[model samples]
Target chain A: MINPQGLMIVLSGPSGVGKGTVRKAIFDHPDTEFEYSISMTTRNMREGEVDGVDYFFKSKKEFEQLIADDKFIEYAQYVDNYYGTPVDYCIETINDGRDIFLEIEVEGAKQVREKFPNALFIFLAPPTLGHLEDRLIGRGTESDDIIKNRIETAKKELEMMSLYDYVVINDEVDAARQTIQSIVTAEHHNRKRIEQQLRKHLLEVD
Target chain B: MINPQGLMIVLSGPSGVGKGTVRKAIFDHPDTEFEYSISMTTRNMREGEVDGVDYFFKSKKEFEQLIADDKFIEYAQYVDNYYGTPVDYCIETINDGRDIFLEIEVEGAKQVREKFPNALFIFLAPPTLGHLEDRLIGRGTESDDIIKNRIETAKKELEMMSLYDYVVINDEVDAARQTIQSIVTAEHHNRKRIEQQLRKHLLEVD
Candidate 1:
C-alpha cells in the first residue's frame, strides 16, 4: 500500500478576526502536530525578527524568479513587496506524512484552494459583525478613516466565509483553537478521505 | 432568526462489530449530551427488561397500526416480532435543539438515511476482515454454519460502509468513543451547517 499523505490545513478569515492570535494559540498548544509553513517575503526583515523562523527573507530578484518558476502556491504584491507561500515545502511536508499548517490571507487561501483543492479551509469568524467592528475600532493605532476602511474590507471578507469548510468563531481564543484541532481530527476519520486505504487493507484480507 | 436544529447522529455497523458496546460507553460517559432514541418493539419483555427504558413495548396490533400510520422511522420484523425506531421522538428532540443518537443495524440506518438525508452516519468498522472473522469464531456458542452465515452478512454490510459520512475503526472502545466525540464537536462548527444563522446575524448587524 502507498503511504498516506498528510492534510493541508489553511486557516484564514477576515482581517481583525484574530486569525493570527487564534493561530498562535493553536501552535502554542502542546498537542499541535502540524508543521507550520513559514511564508516567504521580499520585504525587509524588521528588528528582532528571525531570518527563517518569523519569515523567509528573500531578495526582490529571488522572489520574482520563484514566481516565474511557479514555486509558490500563492503570491501577492503589496506596496512593491512580494509575499507568498512556497509550494515545495508544503508538498514535501505533506508527502512525508506530516500535516502542514498555513495561516494566510483570504486571497492567498483562494490561491491555495486552486492548487490544493482537497486542503482543509477553516475561516476564523467573529462572534458577530458588530464584534468585528469593535475589535477594528479598539485598536487605537489606526485613525477613524483607516478603521472605517478596515471595517469595509472585513465585511467583504466575511462574505467569503462560504468558501471555508469550517468556521471557528473567535469569541474566545482557546475555544477556537480547540475547534480547529477537533476539525483536523475528525477530517482524518472522514470516509471520503480514508476509504481508499481501508479498501486496500480489506482486499488484502480477502 | 429561527432556532437552530440539533444534529441526528446514526451509529451503524455490521453485526457483532460492538455497536451496542460503543453506544453504551458513549451514553455512560458524563459528557454525552445526545438524547438516546429508545427503540419500540413488539417482542416480549424479558425478565429484567423494563418498558420505556429497555424498549417501548407495544402490542402486535399497535405495532401494525404504527407501521400503517408511518409512525416509525424504520422497522423490521424478526421471528414474528416487530422492532423499530419511532419518528416523533427524534424530530421532537432535534426541534428542541438537542441532538438525538440512534444505534441500529445497517438496514435500519439505511432507512433512516432515506428520511434524514443530512444526518451524520458513522460506520463502525472492524480493524480488519481477519479480526472480524476471529471475533465471529471466538463467540464459540454459534455453530459453524451460523458463524459462516454471519461472516457473509458482515462482508455485505461492510460494503455498505461507503454510504456513511465517517468510518471509525473499532480498534479500542475508548479510542473510538473519543474520535466520535470529536467528530460531533467538529461537525457543530461545520460552515455549511451554521452559515445560515451567522448570515442572519451579519445581515442584522449591517
Candidate 2:
C-alpha cells in the first residue's frame, strides 16, 4: 500500500477499448487531484492541438536531445512518431501532491511498469469483442482492412493483460469508472504508511 | 492480480497495534465481502466477550473434539490458550465469493500463507519501535512487566512484516483504511481474469 497524495497511474488497453473515455470520467471525478501526463512526440500536431496540453510536440532534434539527457522516462519510435512520457514532468507533478495519469499502449505500459514498480497499472478492456469491432467499424476514418488490423491487434493486446497490476473490464462504463476511482482512493491506504500514521496518532492522542 | 473475491486475507500485527480496530473498520466498509474468522479457544471467555463473535469460547474438551474431527482450519496453542480458526467456515465463506479475513498471530499467518498461496497476507504495524511502546502503554491494560514483554514481542512482529505480501501501518484509522481498500480493490482487477475475459470476448465476437 502507498499514499493517496501522489501516484503515477498507467491506463493501457487496445485501440477500441474505450480507454480514453474511462480516463475522461476519472479526470472529471469530484475532488480528484490527478493530472494527465503530456506525451512528448516528434509527430506534427493537427489543428487545435496545443503544445504541453494535447502533447508537447517536439522536433526530431529536441526529442533526440531529451532522449540523450534521459529526460524522457520511456520513449519509443512507432511508425515515425517518436512518442514517450516526459520523466521530469511526472516526477514534479507527483512531488506537488498530485498524481500523473498516463494513457499509453501495451508496449509503453510495460516500459513504465519497469521504471515505476509501485505505480498503479490499470488495464481497461472492452465490454465485448463484438462491441470492440462495432466501435472500430463505426469509426468512419478506417477502412475494413484497417478495422480488421485493429481487431487483430486487440487480440494480441488481450494476451498481455496478465502483465498488468489490474485488469478492469469496461463492460459497464459507470461501474468501471467507479472501480477505477475506488481503486485509486484505496491505494493510498497500503500497509506501511497506514502504520506510520496510526503509530503517530496513537502516540499523539494522549 | 487475479476475483480476489474468494481469496483468504491473513492479518497479523504486534499486540496493542490495534489490529482488531483496523479489522473492524475493514469489515464495516460497504461493498466489501469478507468473513472475519472467529477463532475457537480452549481458554474460558472473559466477561463481555461474545460466543461465536469474539471467539468460539470452546472448552478444552470441545476444542480437542473439533481437532479430532478435523474441524479447525489452522489452530495452535498460544500463551496457554488453544486458538484456531475453523477451516470449514473459511472454505465455505471463500467458496461463497466472499474473501476470508483471518486475524492471527505471525506464526498462524505463516501457516495460512503456506496453505493458501493465493491468500493475501497483510501485516499491520506502527510507524516505529518507539511509537509501538507508546500505543501499548497507552492501552493501560497491561502491567509494567507485561508491557515490556509486549514491546519485545512487537519487535519480533515488526521483523516479520517483510514476509507479508503487504504491510499496513496503523498511523491513522481512516487513511490506513483507505490504503487497504485501494490495494484490495486494485487487486480485484486481476490480470488473469481480464486476459481470460478478453480472449473469451474476442472468440465470441469473431
Candidate 3:
C-alpha cells in the first residue's frame, strides 16, 4: 500500500490551556502514528529533565550559531532563552511518513506557517476566556501580577485563533484529544493525497 | 452552550461504489447528528418504498412545476425521470443546526457546489479501478455490456475525484464509516466557527 505522505501539524495555545495534557493523551494512544518534534532551547536544564527528551538543551553561543546558520524553522527568545524547532528534523520526520507535532506559541506558529503553509495548524483554546483566566489564577504558585500578565497574553493568543485551521476547546481533556486525533485521521484521507494513489490505480487499469 | 452550525456535506461516487452503504453506517451511529436529505424523484414508487422516506415521489407534472418554480437546489433528468433536492428543505435543515448529507452523482454534486461552495465535498472510491471493476462484476445481476458501460462511467467519475475535498477508499466498510465520522467531528471544531464562539467568550470577560 502506498500510504499518503504524513501531515505536518503545528499546535499552538496560550499558557495554562492544557495543550500539554491533551497532546500527552493523544501520543499515549498506541495507535497514534505521530512523531513529537523535539525543540532546541538555550535554557539551563531543570532537575530531572533529560537532555534530548525534555529539550535539546544548548548553550547560548551554540543556539546563536544555529540561528546564524538559519537552522531553526522558527525561533523566539523567551525570558532570555532562545527556543526553536530544528528545521531539518521536522522535515525529515514528516518525509518519513509520520505526522510531526510542533507545539509552540502563536508567534512561533506564525513564523512556521510562512515556511510550511500547507501544514495543519491547530489552536488549543479554553472553553471560555473566563475559564482561561480562572485556570491561570487557579495556580497558586504564580503571583497576582504574573497571573494578570498571563491572562492578558492569553487574550492576545485567543485573538490569533482565527488563523488556525482547527481549534480544539480544552473543555474536557479526553474530548479535546479525540478531536485532535480525528483531525489527523481525516486529513490522511484528503483528496490531495488520494489523488496520487488514484492516478496509480488508473495506470494499472490502462 | 452554543452548538456549531451544521455542515453541508456532499458524498459523490460512481455506481457500485458503495456510497450508500458507507452513508448508512455513518448515520446508524447513535451519536451521529445528521439529517439525510430526502431527494425528490419523478420515478414510480416501487413496492416497499414509502413516499418521503425512500424518496419523495412526484408526478411528472409536479416535478416539472417544481423545476419551473426553481424549487430544486440541484436537479437532473436521469433515465427519463427527474430527480432533485428541494432547495428549502436542505437550507432549513442545515440552518437548524443539523448536518445534512447529500448523496448524489458527480454532476449533481458539482451543481450543488455552485450554491454551497464551502460545503465539504467527499468522493468515495473503491480501493482501485481494478477493485471497482471486480465489485461491479461481482453483483452478477447486470449483463456484461451494462457492466462494461458502468465501468466506463465509473472511470469518468473517478476523474472528478480531484474536484472533491476528501476521497475515502471504500476498502473496508467500518473503517470508511469511521473516517467519515471523523471528518464531521473535526469540521465542527474548525477555527472559522470557533472564532465566533471565542469572540462571545471574550465579550463576557469584558
* Model 2 stretches astray by more than 4 angstroms: A1-7, A41-51, A57-71, A76-82, A94-98, A114-119, A139-141, A181-206, B1-5, B43-47, B192-198, B201-203
In model 1, what are the clashing residue pairs, if there are any?
none
Q: RMSD, each candidate, Å?
A: 2.9, 4.2, 2.8
TM-score to true structure, per model: 0.90, 0.82, 0.89
Candidate 3, lDDT over the whole model = 0.81
**Cα lDDT tens digits for candidate 3, B1-206:** 55546789888888788886787787788877789998888877756668987689999999999899999889987546787888887898888888899887777888998988879898888777778788878867667988888888888888888889888889899998889989888878777755786667654763
TM-score of chain A of 2: 0.82
Q: Model 1, B6-92: lDDT tens per residue?
A: 899999988778786788889899989999999888877756668887689999999999999999999877436787999999999
lDDT of 1 by residue, A32-118 (tens): 999999889887775666888768999999999999998999987743677789998999999999899998878889988887889
The better-scoring model by lDDT among 1 and 2 is 1
Q: Is the docking of candidate 2 incorrect, acceptable, medium or high quality?
A: acceptable
DockQ of each: 0.61, 0.32, 0.57
Q: What docking grade applies to model 1?
A: medium
Better of 2 and 3 by DockQ: 3
Cα-based lDDT at residue A57, candidate 1: 94
Every model's TM-score on chain B: 0.85, 0.85, 0.85
Q: Give the poorly placed runs of model 1, Cα more than 4 Å off.
A: A1-3, A42-51, A57-62, A78-82, A203-206, B1-3, B41-62, B77-82, B139-141
Query: How do the residues B1-206 of candidate 2 rate in per-residue lDDT, one tens digit apiece?
Result: 23424767787878777776787788788955667898888776656768888788888888899989988768887656788888888998888877778887777777777788777777777766677788878777667888888777776667676567576677897766766666666667656434564456555764
**Interface C-alpha root-mean-square deviation, candidates in order:** 2.2, 4.8, 2.4
